[model samples]
Target: MKKFPMTVGGEKALREELDDLKTVQRPTVIASIAEAREHGDLKENAEYHAAREQQGFIEGRIQELEGKLGSAQVIDVTQIPHTGKVIFGTTVDLINMDTEDTVCYQIVGDDEANIKGGKISISSPIARALIGKEEGDVAVVQTPGGGVEYEIDQVRHI
Candidate 1:
């Protein structure tokens, strides 16, 4: 499988989740399944069915996390040399040319992209346009609504 880029923090978060699922959730589900099995009737038991469903979901998630963790290339923003150019895991300050409104966004991995947290996916239109561009450069992004232009004000590796 191809390796995916992930920020150091994002990779750590996934690792923590994987650990929790393996140590806590897996045991809890196993215990629940065993308890449900003790209720006797296997075919018509609603509790048993629910426990089995929960087990399936937990197992699936564990496997997914494991796969992602195995193939993730974790990039630490702090370790990157401070360059004015925009790059992955760099926080960028931008000003919308039309509205004159300033917005800050950190380019991050797909799994860690959260607009509310000021993180944009690396594959996003804005990030793609901003990549390798230095401060004071304009990035023209094609949004769903319309074309938007943003002027890069600063780039910080944080």
Candidate 2:
């Protein structure tokens, strides 16, 4: 089985979702299905069909979460010694060589990546280029337009 690397926060979020699905959603959907069953025949009952569909979705999500949680390798970046080199779960500050603009991004797992939140996926082109690079080193990221160079200004465990 492939191990899923994730931050502590990411693991916690998935666990929370799993808990909600099992404790709240599963029971609620069961109740809905039972109530819909009393209303009419199975073939023409819209409410019963809708409830069953919702139940399928909830069950599927629960299984997916469980599988992810089972294989998750949670990495708490704060516990690692800082070495000024970009690594998984490290926050990196970079200066664009061509535009002179700066950007800060936290290297995170695929499920936890959010560009608006300054988190980039570990498998992304830019993050892949930045990995193993130290402060003051320039990383060239290949993009569709062309290669873009970013100078690593800082690498933080926090």
| Candidate 1: tens digits of C-alpha lDDT, residues 24-80 | 999998999999999999999999899899999999999999889889999998998
The estimated TM-scores of all candidates read 0.96, 0.96
lDDT of 1 at 9: 89
The reply for model 2, stretches above 4 Å from the true place, is none
Candidate lDDT (C-alpha), each: 0.94, 0.95
Q: What tens-digit string does per-residue lDDT give for candidate 2 at 1-158? A: 88978999899989899999999999999999999999879899999999999999999999888888888889999999999999999999999999999999999999899999999999999999999999999999999999999999999998
